[model samples]
Target: MDKNRMELNGFKWPDGDVHCRKVVFSSVIDMEPALRLTDGRAVAVQAGGNCGVWPAWLAERFERVFTFEPDQTNFDCLVQNVPENVTAYRAALGSKRGRVGMCLDTRNIGAHFIDGKGSIPVKTIDSLKLKACDYLCLDVEGYEMPALIGSVQTINEHRPVIQIEDKGLSERYGYQRGEAIDWLKMLGYRVRHRVARDVILSCAPA
Candidate 1:
Protein backbone atom coordinates (compact mmCIF):
# COMPACT_ATOMS: atom_id res chain seq x y z
CA MET A 1 0.00 0.00 0.00
CA ASP A 2 1.19 3.49 -0.76
CA LYS A 3 1.92 5.32 2.49
CA ASN A 4 0.96 8.70 1.02
CA ARG A 5 -2.39 7.40 -0.14
CA MET A 6 -2.76 5.77 3.25
CA GLU A 7 -2.27 9.19 4.82
CA LEU A 8 -5.00 10.44 2.52
CA ASN A 9 -7.35 7.58 3.37
CA GLY A 10 -9.43 9.59 5.78
CA PHE A 11 -8.26 13.09 4.85
CA LYS A 12 -10.49 15.82 3.47
CA TRP A 13 -8.13 16.57 0.61
CA PRO A 14 -6.44 13.40 -0.53
CA ASP A 15 -5.62 14.14 -4.09
CA GLY A 16 -1.99 15.11 -4.65
CA ASP A 17 1.27 14.12 -3.06
CA VAL A 18 1.28 15.09 0.60
CA HIS A 19 4.11 17.54 0.07
CA CYS A 20 2.42 19.15 -2.91
CA ARG A 21 -1.02 19.74 -1.45
CA LYS A 22 -2.13 23.37 -1.22
CA VAL A 23 -3.25 23.00 2.38
CA VAL A 24 -1.44 20.86 4.87
CA PHE A 25 -3.35 18.22 6.81
CA SER A 26 -3.78 19.67 10.26
CA SER A 27 -4.30 17.36 13.19
CA VAL A 28 -6.26 20.22 14.71
CA ILE A 29 -7.35 23.22 12.67
CA ASP A 30 -6.49 25.78 15.34
CA MET A 31 -4.31 25.32 18.41
CA GLU A 32 -4.26 28.63 20.31
CA PRO A 33 -7.77 28.27 21.75
CA ALA A 34 -7.23 24.75 22.97
CA LEU A 35 -3.85 25.69 24.38
CA ARG A 36 -5.43 28.47 26.40
CA LEU A 37 -8.13 26.20 27.84
CA THR A 38 -7.22 25.12 31.35
CA ASP A 39 -10.02 22.66 32.10
CA GLY A 40 -13.60 21.32 31.67
CA ARG A 41 -15.52 19.12 29.21
CA ALA A 42 -15.67 19.82 25.47
CA VAL A 43 -18.23 19.14 22.74
CA ALA A 44 -17.17 18.71 19.11
CA VAL A 45 -19.87 18.61 16.46
CA GLN A 46 -19.40 17.45 12.84
CA ALA A 47 -17.23 14.54 13.77
CA GLY A 48 -16.24 13.64 10.22
CA GLY A 49 -13.22 12.78 12.23
CA ASN A 50 -10.66 12.47 9.48
CA CYS A 51 -8.26 10.41 11.61
CA GLY A 52 -9.78 11.71 14.84
CA VAL A 53 -7.01 14.25 15.08
CA TRP A 54 -9.17 17.10 16.36
CA PRO A 55 -11.05 14.91 18.83
CA ALA A 56 -7.79 13.52 20.11
CA TRP A 57 -6.61 17.08 20.56
CA LEU A 58 -9.69 17.87 22.64
CA ALA A 59 -9.36 14.67 24.66
CA GLU A 60 -5.79 15.52 25.54
CA ARG A 61 -6.79 18.82 27.13
CA PHE A 62 -10.35 18.47 28.40
CA GLU A 63 -11.72 16.29 31.17
CA ARG A 64 -13.98 14.57 28.63
CA VAL A 65 -14.94 14.99 24.99
CA PHE A 66 -18.23 14.31 23.23
CA THR A 67 -18.07 14.29 19.43
CA PHE A 68 -20.67 13.49 16.76
CA GLU A 69 -20.33 12.42 13.13
CA PRO A 70 -23.17 11.15 10.91
CA ASP A 71 -21.17 9.68 8.08
CA GLN A 72 -20.58 5.99 8.65
CA THR A 73 -17.50 5.92 6.50
CA ASN A 74 -15.82 8.65 8.53
CA PHE A 75 -17.30 7.40 11.79
CA ASP A 76 -15.63 4.05 11.33
CA CYS A 77 -12.18 5.59 11.33
CA LEU A 78 -13.14 8.18 13.94
CA VAL A 79 -14.12 5.41 16.34
CA GLN A 80 -10.65 3.96 16.06
CA ASN A 81 -8.68 7.18 16.56
CA VAL A 82 -10.21 8.81 19.62
CA PRO A 83 -8.90 8.31 23.15
CA GLU A 84 -10.83 6.66 25.96
CA ASN A 85 -11.98 10.03 27.31
CA VAL A 86 -13.60 10.91 24.03
CA THR A 87 -17.10 9.62 23.34
CA ALA A 88 -17.89 9.35 19.65
CA TYR A 89 -21.51 9.43 18.50
CA ARG A 90 -22.79 8.41 15.09
CA ALA A 91 -25.47 11.06 14.68
CA ALA A 92 -26.07 14.48 13.18
CA LEU A 93 -26.86 17.59 15.27
CA GLY A 94 -29.31 20.26 14.14
CA SER A 95 -31.73 22.95 15.38
CA LYS A 96 -34.52 20.44 15.71
CA ARG A 97 -34.85 16.70 16.10
CA GLY A 98 -35.37 14.80 12.86
CA ARG A 99 -33.69 13.02 9.99
CA VAL A 100 -32.20 14.92 7.02
CA GLY A 101 -30.37 14.20 3.79
CA MET A 102 -26.57 14.19 3.88
CA CYS A 103 -24.48 15.22 0.93
CA LEU A 104 -21.18 13.38 0.90
CA ASP A 105 -18.15 14.67 -0.92
CA THR A 106 -16.05 11.62 -1.68
CA ARG A 107 -12.97 13.71 -2.33
CA ASN A 108 -13.20 15.34 1.08
CA ILE A 109 -14.69 13.16 3.78
CA GLY A 110 -14.73 16.11 6.17
CA ALA A 111 -17.24 18.01 3.97
CA HIS A 112 -20.23 15.74 4.56
CA PHE A 113 -23.47 17.52 5.56
CA ILE A 114 -27.29 17.26 5.52
CA ASP A 115 -27.74 18.65 2.02
CA GLY A 116 -27.19 15.79 -0.41
CA LYS A 117 -26.83 12.00 -0.81
CA GLY A 118 -28.15 9.97 2.15
CA SER A 119 -30.51 10.65 5.00
CA ILE A 120 -29.48 10.70 8.68
CA PRO A 121 -31.18 11.44 11.97
CA VAL A 122 -30.40 14.75 13.71
CA LYS A 123 -30.59 15.42 17.43
CA THR A 124 -30.50 18.66 19.39
CA ILE A 125 -27.65 19.46 21.76
CA ASP A 126 -30.13 20.44 24.46
CA SER A 127 -31.32 16.84 24.47
CA LEU A 128 -27.87 15.58 25.44
CA LYS A 129 -28.63 16.49 29.07
CA LEU A 130 -25.16 17.83 29.50
CA LYS A 131 -24.55 19.65 32.76
CA ALA A 132 -21.64 21.77 31.60
CA CYS A 133 -18.95 22.22 29.00
CA ASP A 134 -15.92 24.50 28.58
CA TYR A 135 -15.41 24.33 24.86
CA LEU A 136 -17.56 23.86 21.76
CA CYS A 137 -16.23 23.18 18.26
CA LEU A 138 -18.49 23.03 15.19
CA ASP A 139 -17.47 22.12 11.64
CA VAL A 140 -20.64 20.64 10.17
CA GLU A 141 -20.23 22.19 6.72
CA GLY A 142 -23.11 24.73 6.60
CA TYR A 143 -25.36 23.19 9.21
CA GLU A 144 -23.73 25.04 12.08
CA MET A 145 -26.64 27.45 12.46
CA PRO A 146 -29.30 24.83 13.11
CA ALA A 147 -27.00 22.92 15.40
CA LEU A 148 -26.29 26.11 17.34
CA ILE A 149 -30.01 26.73 17.59
CA GLY A 150 -30.36 23.33 19.20
CA SER A 151 -27.58 24.16 21.61
CA VAL A 152 -28.99 27.47 22.83
CA GLN A 153 -29.71 26.17 26.29
CA THR A 154 -26.34 24.55 26.49
CA ILE A 155 -24.61 27.73 25.40
CA ASN A 156 -26.45 29.91 27.89
CA GLU A 157 -26.07 27.45 30.72
CA HIS A 158 -22.56 26.15 30.21
CA ARG A 159 -21.04 29.22 28.56
CA PRO A 160 -18.47 27.25 26.62
CA VAL A 161 -16.01 28.91 24.28
CA ILE A 162 -17.12 28.33 20.71
CA GLN A 163 -15.31 27.84 17.41
CA ILE A 164 -17.04 27.28 14.08
CA GLU A 165 -16.02 26.91 10.45
CA ASP A 166 -17.70 29.53 8.26
CA LYS A 167 -16.84 28.62 4.69
CA GLY A 168 -19.96 26.80 3.55
CA LEU A 169 -22.54 29.61 3.55
CA SER A 170 -21.64 30.71 0.05
CA GLU A 171 -21.61 27.06 -0.99
CA ARG A 172 -25.32 26.89 -0.09
CA TYR A 173 -25.43 24.53 2.86
CA GLY A 174 -27.47 26.41 5.48
CA TYR A 175 -25.95 29.48 7.17
CA GLN A 176 -24.69 32.85 6.03
CA ARG A 177 -21.51 34.60 7.07
CA GLY A 178 -21.76 36.35 10.46
CA GLU A 179 -25.11 34.64 11.10
CA ALA A 180 -23.68 32.45 13.83
CA ILE A 181 -21.95 35.45 15.35
CA ASP A 182 -25.27 37.26 15.63
CA TRP A 183 -26.86 34.30 17.36
CA LEU A 184 -23.91 33.88 19.68
CA LYS A 185 -23.91 37.54 20.58
CA MET A 186 -27.56 37.27 21.43
CA LEU A 187 -26.58 34.56 23.87
CA GLY A 188 -23.95 36.74 25.59
CA TYR A 189 -21.01 35.55 23.58
CA ARG A 190 -18.55 37.88 21.84
CA VAL A 191 -16.17 37.43 18.98
CA ARG A 192 -12.81 36.38 20.36
CA HIS A 193 -11.15 36.27 17.00
CA ARG A 194 -11.78 35.73 13.30
CA VAL A 195 -8.95 33.75 11.81
CA ALA A 196 -8.71 32.06 8.45
CA ARG A 197 -11.96 30.13 7.93
CA ASP A 198 -13.05 30.04 11.56
CA VAL A 199 -14.77 32.44 13.90
CA ILE A 200 -14.01 32.01 17.57
CA LEU A 201 -16.57 33.21 20.08
CA SER A 202 -16.26 33.43 23.82
CA CYS A 203 -18.75 34.02 26.61
CA ALA A 204 -16.78 36.92 28.02
CA PRO A 205 -18.20 40.06 29.59
CA ALA A 206 -19.21 42.64 27.00
Candidate 2:
Protein backbone atom coordinates (compact mmCIF):
# COMPACT_ATOMS: atom_id res chain seq x y z
CA MET A 1 0.00 0.00 0.00
CA ASP A 2 1.22 3.55 -0.62
CA LYS A 3 2.34 5.46 2.46
CA ASN A 4 -0.48 7.98 2.00
CA ARG A 5 -3.03 5.27 1.28
CA MET A 6 -4.86 3.66 4.19
CA GLU A 7 -5.37 -0.10 4.35
CA LEU A 8 -8.65 -1.65 5.31
CA ASN A 9 -10.34 -5.03 5.31
CA GLY A 10 -11.25 -5.74 1.68
CA PHE A 11 -14.80 -5.73 0.31
CA LYS A 12 -16.70 -8.99 -0.31
CA TRP A 13 -19.18 -9.39 -3.16
CA PRO A 14 -21.21 -12.28 -4.46
CA ASP A 15 -19.28 -12.52 -7.70
CA GLY A 16 -15.83 -11.45 -6.42
CA ASP A 17 -13.89 -9.17 -4.11
CA VAL A 18 -11.97 -5.88 -4.31
CA HIS A 19 -9.44 -4.13 -2.09
CA CYS A 20 -10.09 -0.39 -2.37
CA ARG A 21 -7.48 2.04 -1.19
CA LYS A 22 -9.20 5.42 -1.43
CA VAL A 23 -11.57 7.28 -3.72
CA VAL A 24 -10.35 10.29 -5.67
CA PHE A 25 -12.72 12.91 -7.04
CA SER A 26 -12.41 14.80 -10.29
CA SER A 27 -11.43 18.40 -9.70
CA VAL A 28 -14.26 19.73 -11.83
CA ILE A 29 -16.91 17.54 -10.27
CA ASP A 30 -15.63 18.24 -6.80
CA MET A 31 -15.89 21.98 -7.29
CA GLU A 32 -19.38 22.12 -8.76
CA PRO A 33 -22.34 22.39 -6.44
CA ALA A 34 -24.87 19.59 -6.75
CA LEU A 35 -27.77 21.77 -5.67
CA ARG A 36 -27.96 25.20 -4.07
CA LEU A 37 -24.91 24.83 -1.84
CA THR A 38 -23.17 27.95 -3.09
CA ASP A 39 -23.28 29.74 0.27
CA GLY A 40 -21.92 26.56 1.85
CA ARG A 41 -24.58 26.54 4.57
CA ALA A 42 -25.85 23.16 3.49
CA VAL A 43 -26.03 19.73 5.07
CA ALA A 44 -24.60 16.80 3.15
CA VAL A 45 -24.56 13.02 3.63
CA GLN A 46 -22.06 10.62 2.14
CA ALA A 47 -23.09 6.98 2.50
CA GLY A 48 -20.37 4.38 2.09
CA GLY A 49 -17.49 6.78 2.36
CA ASN A 50 -14.51 4.47 1.77
CA CYS A 51 -11.57 6.60 2.91
CA GLY A 52 -13.29 9.97 3.49
CA VAL A 53 -11.75 11.76 0.50
CA TRP A 54 -15.06 12.88 -1.01
CA PRO A 55 -16.68 13.70 2.31
CA ALA A 56 -13.63 15.53 3.59
CA TRP A 57 -13.35 17.49 0.38
CA LEU A 58 -17.03 18.39 0.42
CA ALA A 59 -16.80 19.32 4.09
CA GLU A 60 -14.30 21.98 3.15
CA ARG A 61 -16.93 23.51 0.86
CA PHE A 62 -20.04 22.83 2.91
CA GLU A 63 -21.12 23.97 6.33
CA ARG A 64 -21.97 20.52 7.65
CA VAL A 65 -21.31 17.07 6.28
CA PHE A 66 -21.96 13.53 7.57
CA THR A 67 -20.45 10.27 6.38
CA PHE A 68 -20.89 6.57 7.25
CA GLU A 69 -18.68 3.51 6.86
CA PRO A 70 -18.80 0.21 8.74
CA ASP A 71 -15.30 -1.10 8.15
CA GLN A 72 -13.04 -0.43 11.13
CA THR A 73 -9.92 0.07 9.05
CA ASN A 74 -11.74 2.47 6.77
CA PHE A 75 -13.19 4.24 9.78
CA ASP A 76 -9.73 4.76 11.22
CA CYS A 77 -8.56 6.31 7.97
CA LEU A 78 -11.70 8.40 7.78
CA VAL A 79 -11.02 9.82 11.22
CA GLN A 80 -7.59 10.90 10.07
CA ASN A 81 -8.69 12.54 6.82
CA VAL A 82 -12.19 13.82 7.59
CA PRO A 83 -12.54 17.44 8.66
CA GLU A 84 -14.16 18.57 11.91
CA ASN A 85 -17.17 19.88 9.99
CA VAL A 86 -17.84 16.40 8.72
CA THR A 87 -19.29 13.95 11.25
CA ALA A 88 -18.07 10.43 10.51
CA TYR A 89 -20.00 7.38 11.64
CA ARG A 90 -18.41 3.97 12.05
CA ALA A 91 -21.69 2.22 11.24
CA ALA A 92 -23.58 1.15 8.16
CA LEU A 93 -26.75 2.91 7.05
CA GLY A 94 -29.55 0.56 6.09
CA SER A 95 -33.33 0.47 5.73
CA LYS A 96 -33.66 -0.57 9.34
CA ARG A 97 -32.13 0.62 12.55
CA GLY A 98 -30.32 -2.26 14.26
CA ARG A 99 -27.27 -4.45 14.23
CA VAL A 100 -26.19 -6.25 11.03
CA GLY A 101 -23.16 -8.13 9.75
CA MET A 102 -21.02 -6.41 7.12
CA CYS A 103 -18.99 -8.72 4.90
CA LEU A 104 -15.49 -7.71 3.89
CA ASP A 105 -13.75 -8.45 0.61
CA THR A 106 -10.17 -9.34 1.45
CA ARG A 107 -9.02 -8.24 -1.98
CA ASN A 108 -10.76 -4.89 -2.46
CA ILE A 109 -11.79 -3.31 0.79
CA GLY A 110 -14.12 -0.89 -1.03
CA ALA A 111 -16.48 -3.57 -2.36
CA HIS A 112 -17.71 -4.70 1.03
CA PHE A 113 -21.28 -5.80 1.84
CA ILE A 114 -24.23 -7.11 -0.14
CA ASP A 115 -27.80 -5.89 0.23
CA GLY A 116 -29.30 -8.69 2.34
CA LYS A 117 -26.13 -10.03 3.92
CA GLY A 118 -23.36 -8.42 5.95
CA SER A 119 -25.75 -7.45 8.67
CA ILE A 120 -24.17 -4.90 11.00
CA PRO A 121 -25.14 -2.13 13.40
CA VAL A 122 -26.93 0.64 11.53
CA LYS A 123 -29.33 3.58 11.77
CA THR A 124 -31.90 4.52 9.19
CA ILE A 125 -31.81 8.04 7.71
CA ASP A 126 -35.38 8.57 8.86
CA SER A 127 -34.23 8.19 12.42
CA LEU A 128 -31.56 10.79 11.90
CA LYS A 129 -34.11 13.55 11.13
CA LEU A 130 -31.61 15.19 8.83
CA LYS A 131 -33.56 17.88 7.07
CA ALA A 132 -32.49 20.37 4.41
CA CYS A 133 -29.47 18.45 3.18
CA ASP A 134 -28.37 20.05 -0.09
CA TYR A 135 -26.46 17.10 -1.43
CA LEU A 136 -26.45 13.33 -0.89
CA CYS A 137 -24.00 10.78 -2.25
CA LEU A 138 -24.36 6.99 -2.04
CA ASP A 139 -21.98 4.28 -3.21
CA VAL A 140 -22.88 1.42 -0.92
CA GLU A 141 -22.18 -1.42 -3.33
CA GLY A 142 -25.43 -3.38 -3.88
CA TYR A 143 -26.96 -2.11 -0.66
CA GLU A 144 -27.93 1.22 -2.23
CA MET A 145 -31.61 0.32 -2.24
CA PRO A 146 -31.73 -0.40 1.47
CA ALA A 147 -29.83 2.78 2.21
CA LEU A 148 -32.23 4.78 0.05
CA ILE A 149 -35.17 3.10 1.69
CA GLY A 150 -33.81 4.22 5.01
CA SER A 151 -33.48 7.76 3.75
CA VAL A 152 -36.94 8.19 2.29
CA GLN A 153 -37.93 10.68 4.93
CA THR A 154 -34.75 12.64 4.56
CA ILE A 155 -35.00 12.72 0.79
CA ASN A 156 -38.61 13.85 0.84
CA GLU A 157 -37.98 16.45 3.47
CA HIS A 158 -34.69 17.85 2.23
CA ARG A 159 -34.97 17.23 -1.49
CA PRO A 160 -31.21 16.91 -1.80
CA VAL A 161 -29.51 16.32 -5.10
CA ILE A 162 -28.20 12.73 -5.10
CA GLN A 163 -25.16 11.33 -6.83
CA ILE A 164 -25.19 7.52 -6.94
CA GLU A 165 -23.08 4.85 -8.55
CA ASP A 166 -25.38 2.72 -10.72
CA LYS A 167 -23.30 0.35 -12.76
CA GLY A 168 -24.82 -2.86 -14.17
CA LEU A 169 -23.68 -4.83 -11.11
CA SER A 170 -27.35 -5.31 -10.16
CA GLU A 171 -27.36 -8.74 -11.82
CA ARG A 172 -24.79 -9.93 -9.34
CA TYR A 173 -27.14 -8.85 -6.57
CA GLY A 174 -30.41 -9.97 -8.23
CA TYR A 175 -31.70 -6.44 -8.87
CA GLN A 176 -31.91 -4.02 -11.76
CA ARG A 177 -30.56 -0.51 -12.28
CA GLY A 178 -33.93 0.58 -13.68
CA GLU A 179 -35.62 -0.51 -10.49
CA ALA A 180 -33.45 1.81 -8.46
CA ILE A 181 -34.01 4.71 -10.84
CA ASP A 182 -37.73 4.07 -10.88
CA TRP A 183 -37.83 4.17 -7.11
CA LEU A 184 -35.99 7.48 -7.13
CA LYS A 185 -38.33 8.91 -9.75
CA MET A 186 -41.33 7.84 -7.73
CA LEU A 187 -39.79 9.78 -4.88
CA GLY A 188 -39.91 12.89 -7.14
CA TYR A 189 -36.27 13.01 -8.26
CA ARG A 190 -35.32 13.73 -11.84
CA VAL A 191 -32.26 12.40 -13.59
CA ARG A 192 -30.00 15.40 -13.77
CA HIS A 193 -26.71 13.97 -14.93
CA ARG A 194 -25.28 10.69 -16.16
CA VAL A 195 -21.54 10.17 -16.20
CA ALA A 196 -20.83 6.74 -17.55
CA ARG A 197 -21.81 4.45 -14.66
CA ASP A 198 -22.74 7.24 -12.30
CA VAL A 199 -26.24 8.77 -12.06
CA ILE A 200 -27.11 12.04 -10.47
CA LEU A 201 -30.71 12.79 -9.40
CA SER A 202 -32.17 16.12 -8.40
CA CYS A 203 -35.55 17.20 -7.02
CA ALA A 204 -37.16 20.55 -6.60
CA PRO A 205 -37.55 21.86 -3.09
CA ALA A 206 -40.55 20.40 -1.33
Query: Using lDDT as the measure, which candidate wins?
Result: 2
TM-scores, all candidates, are 0.81, 0.79
lDDT of 2 at 169: 62
Tell me the whole-model lDDT of each prediction, alpha carbons only: 0.68, 0.70
Off by over 4 Å in 1: 1-29, 34-48, 116-118, 168-174
Instruction: Kindly give the stretch of ten consecutive residues in candidate 1 with the minimal lDDT sum.
Output: 13-22
Give the top-scoring candidate (TM-score).
1
Model 2 regions more than 4 Å off: 1-19, 22-40, 115-119, 171-174
Each prediction's RMSD to truth: 4.0, 5.4
What does candidate 1's lDDT look like per residue over 1-206, in tens digits? 33223444354333322332334245365745644642454444434444466777777777778888787666665676678988887888888887777776766666556774446778888898787677788877777888888988888888888888777563475456778878888888778776678888886653
Clashing pairs for model 1 are: 95-146, 103-116
Model 1 TM: 0.81
